[model samples]
Target: MRTGEGLLGRLAEGGRRPLVVDSSLAALYAAGSLVLGQETPAAPWQPMDALGRVLILLVSAALTVRRVAPVPVLAAVIALWLGYIGCGYWPVVNSPAVLLALYTVAAAHRTRTAAVCAAAVGVTWVVAGLLGGRYTPLPAVAVQAVAFPGVVAFLGRGAGVSAERSRRLAVLTDRLRAEQELRAERAVTEERVRIARELHDVVAHHMSVVSLQAGMASYVVEVDPVTAKGALEAIATTSREALEELRRLLALLRVGPEGEPEGAGEAAPYAPAPGLDRLEELVRRVRAAGVPTELRREGTPFRLPPGMDLCAYRVVQEALTNVLRHAGPAAAVVLVRYAARTLTVRITDDGNRSAPADSPSTGGHGLIGMHERAKIYRGTVSAGPRAGGGFEVELRLPAPHAAGGEPVGRPHP
Candidate 1:
């Protein structure tokens, strides 16, 4: 009736419990049989003697291990039942123990094996009926023999089926939960990588310019007041721009419950991301930092997808920053080519000096960021010291047929 309430259920509760519970069951059954045997008068049947009492105790004790070794226990209990009957004792006193053994066997084994056990117990009952029948009718004995074991076996089969289904459902639920956790962890790792890459690009580019302007301003403060004043102004303007870009990056972290910005109602909208169209402004800034820079366009230009546009612009900015920091006294030229199916940007410097051991152009975080950004668009970036002089970084990206490329809705940092 309950989920796990029968003989087999009690045995499966835990290790060491079956022995205690079954021993108690056997003791109760033995005591009841002894009391019943003493009360029965010596009429319609001979009264139980020492031998009959001993057989009843043996059959009750066998019930203790019915779940552990069901088949052997059933055989032993049936043999003891026959012995008790042969001693001229009423067979009904031992019938309950025999039927309990039959149910134990059915619950513990497959249907075929349980059915075989049922048949064996049924035959034993018929034998007991024939040998000990004093006043009971033969037809009634025949019906009892077949009906009792059959119904018990049927109930035992249902218990076995229910237990198996519960086990399988528990396993499936655990497997699905583990898979969901794994996927969540992977998504978190990817988002962290994206944020790290964006932070490196933004900080490296802006800091390089700030460092150059500050140094220039300090050098000319007393010698040429006007030149020094211009340098200081450039430094302040560059610092303000860097702060605005950092604010944009921080905006990515202000998420609300619905995935919108936390202060969407009060805060101003974010400015547009810089793209190839901003190359002229970028070149002017580098030139003002004492690196004579030229921007050139070869092929016809057209609008690109938002994701690809950002990727292209970041690559160029990273390359120029590397040139300013590593290629000492370099004059840089940036060439942008917008072909029918591809976009390529190449930045080359003409400094006679080789980069220091830890320069970004000489394989550092800046170069790595460039390559990572290009990869998002199925593009490639190559950077190294040019054979003639200075360093060069070139990137190539394949554009999709439609304007739609990788999504740009990803958080910047």
Candidate 2:
């Protein structure tokens, strides 16, 4: 994002390999001396021979492999340059090549190998100063010998440390970025699943009731006018309730600040959330759809925590809806049990025996959602065909030390 960061990223992406660049630079420097005929002044040392020219080429070439094989490059370049010095030639072109290899060794390899190159450089420098006929005493030449290579080694080691730190930091930054992206994706998935559950409860339940009542009204309009009129009333009530629930769900999904929906149609007022108190309404709807479902409660009822209440209500709603849709002329019974530490729900219906269409074995999303809801309260759910030609769904939720409430109201006939 910043200028320095952008430049570094582009450089890493666009640059040639390190080996290529090193070889090119070393060759350019060598060509200036070897090709142009400007030789370094080594007075007492003899002129360059054919063997010495060959050694110069070898030293230049070895520089290319410094990064890839630092230890081997150091050996080859130093050996060639030492031979060039032994063959009565002055320390000039090949000397710098040896230094380059020493730097590479310190920069790329371990401390032990770099130490070896530094010691060798010091000894070679002292030997050259003493034997080349330069005017210098032993101690003065020794001091000069150790100082230059020791300085070069220290600088190279510092550079190596910096480069290593940069590499580790880059890897850490990339890992953090990947983790952040995963967290975002997980949050989006959770929101999507919650919306799906709301849609099933809001639309599926009411639509089924409307369909059943409308069909009943059409069937008996002439033969039984009184019954037909009541069916029509039920259909009208179901449709209006469905629209209201949809509007409430849409309001819950509004982004950020709350206000009237910005659309051609005005938003509906918010309604209180449904819970066990509205259990009779759910039963009446199921019965209107021609599926006889009875709700039975054992022990005194208790007010559930808001999250637990919503989860339990949705589980019951989904189970009953599945019975009406897939159970084919079966009667369902819902049993709710309250204890000191747990609340249990059991729904059983005498339906077709092979398998219900929305069973877990069929990989239905509805069954999967019921499982998800139960797991939220550290609960468990089991849904499958029963031994006796039907299907059953059982859910248990933890409710430690939950105080009791008044008895639940009775279900409608």
Candidate 3:
């Protein structure tokens, strides 16, 4: 049985040689039938002569072509069988040709075609049995003639269903992969834009201070050497500080997996971010930029959360930067007041001598970034032109605790 299965497997692979070999095997089986019932001495069947044997061989050869042209081969086999019946051949056992034709029709044809062929074979079988008078009214013989073809048709339908399911799964898998790739690309693009905005804000703010202090130092180098020397020293310190902060921001991009190479001095720069502890220095720098600023603190001193401290510092830094850029060298006031579980910082500037005809729009993205920072710590920011003159910015941040804790100051190295 295993050897026979191997031969059928080779035949099903469908080359011309395998097909021809399968046809020879089917013909041999049919020809052997001529003598199968004759060997039973108790009930001997009539034997075929040379002509009958030749017709049987022709029918078998026709059936060898069944897989390639099932309908035509089935017709030729049925025709040969009819002729054999007309020639007085009784109870012919060479019915393997018809069985092989039925299997081929079921495997190759659609439902309607297979049904028509099955009905025709049934009719021919009944007619032959009636005419030969060797027919039995038994169910077993009828089942043998029809059951093999039905099984073949069922298997063919199953194969079609399996193929369709596989195709659908492949399509779904491809679509999901494409969607995932698109989302990853979008995320990378957004991160790049955010980093660009941060770099612009940091560079513009620090560079403006550096340029102003350097100019002051150059102008007083001969007239007031002592003060000029002090100014130059301040310039150097400010430049170095700016460089350190820039390096810290850049470090965010250097992260890598465990197996990736590490850069020299793997420890991060800029120990902890600046906050309210440096408010006096911030005021001095603004003053050096030719902008007079007043700082006022009210209520009892209290500690603030780390996130709130950072947010407050950024708010003051951006506000003063905007004042120097847009508000000109005007006098500005900085007020910090803590009251009723909230800390409020307000920076207001009077009109500068060279103020532009139109102030920069509050709806601009710089203000939007400040608002986003405030919102992160459950804070609110309001900025607009004052009623009388100048522009004012008010930022209020919620303080969860009022009792003394760690001082609201810069992080220690």
Candidate 4:
């Protein structure tokens, strides 16, 4: 059985006062039979006789089986006692078998069934007592029968309630654990997306610049030796810088103490991050890509947060890519201005050539990614075709480190 039921059964066995009471009563009956006058009973019906000893032994054994087969065993014990009464035996004071059977019925069965069994046993006890010349009032016998079953039923209900409560607690604990795991997984997913977007923006912009300068250096290797050398140098510097940044990002995936010295065999070469100082080279590469562009800077330059610099560079890169893909070989202008508390970047292209209908729209994840980056730095972005037949993208990013830096009434024109 379950733990709760087992505990109740053990407790019931412990509280068996009726068994002790019956043993004492049997001793009294034996003493009375031994000392009484010869005229009291000279036959086998005497309590000290073999037949009486046999009846007592049978009743004692029946008490043990009451818990296993209560109702049926109770019936057998009652029938045996009725036979003793018919054979002229006197009624005993205590009946352990009858008391234990009542308790078992209440503890193991439904309330209604236990009540019926208790009543039947009580009536049989009283009727047998009357036949044996020891009748008791009906009301007194009924009360005695009901008491044992009632106590057992109460104990059983208590055990059942405790079991139900434990089950509910277990279910609630599991639900809470599941919810915590889901939240942790969601957090990891969001961090990965943020990292991927940053990597894409960083790699794409620098790679585009390298491609443009490399192509230029190849074209003018002999025809324009001076310009070709300058282009090659720019290409080499850009490539070195890109490699360094990639290594730094990869290092983030390692498990180690911060700033620990690398072993000679473990040392990995890397490049430094590029900032606004390289804007000139970036512009030249776009120009070489056949999209004539202009680069302008305003306000006093100041240090920028690393994330902000990366985001600014990505916005420019994505805008230029869109122009090359969808704005045809038209001229584009890039303007960068630092004001009281904000930095602005605008790229505009006059749609003079018919862009291929199959060209992918700029309103996809590219624009969404840019918007997400801008929002990280407390900024806003607007992009669409201009009224005069050109596409324009404007971004405004806060620059807290710059003098006069603050959010503007609107993005710079």
Q: Which candidate number would show the highest TM-score if scored against the true structure?
A: 2
The Cα RMSD of model 4 versus the native structure comes to: 11.3
lDDT of 1 by residue, 110-222 (tens): 99998998888888888999888857788888898899989999888788788878988999999989999999999898788778777777777778888898888889889
TM-scores for every predicted model = 0.74, 0.79, 0.55, 0.52
What clash count goes with each model? 0, 0, 0, 7
Among the numbered candidates, top lDDT falls to 1
TM-score winner, 1 or 4: 1
Superposed model 3: Cα runs more than 4 Å off: 1-165, 218-227, 256-270, 296-309, 336-344, 352-365, 371-381, 396-413
Candidate 3 deviation (Cα RMSD): 10.5
Rank the candidate models, highest lDDT first.
1, 2, 3, 4
**Which scores greater on TM-score, model 3 or model 4?**
3
lDDT of 4 by residue, 1-413 (tens): 69568656754775667556645654554444334422344343444456665665566566554554556667777776776666566555225455555666565566676667766766776676566543457666556556644565456545545656787899989998999999999989977877776576657656766776777789989899998888877777767766776776665545356564243237754334556556776677677665799987766566677678777777887787667666765788888887767778898888653553124543255677789989988899888878897888898987766544334344434
lDDT of 3 by residue, 212-323 (tens): 7778778988899987887777777777867877876766566657633235256656346667767787888888777899998876556777667867877787788778
Stretches of candidate 4 off by over 4 Å are 1-161, 255-309, 324-331, 336-344, 351-365, 375-379, 396-413
**lDDT (0 to 1) per candidate:** 0.81, 0.75, 0.70, 0.66
Candidate 1: C-alpha lDDT: 0.81
Off by over 4 Å in 1: 1-46, 49-89, 101-116, 119-147, 297-303, 333-335, 339-341, 345-396, 402-413
Worst 10 residues of 2 by lDDT: 404-413
Q: Is candidate 1 or candidate 2 better by lDDT?
A: 1
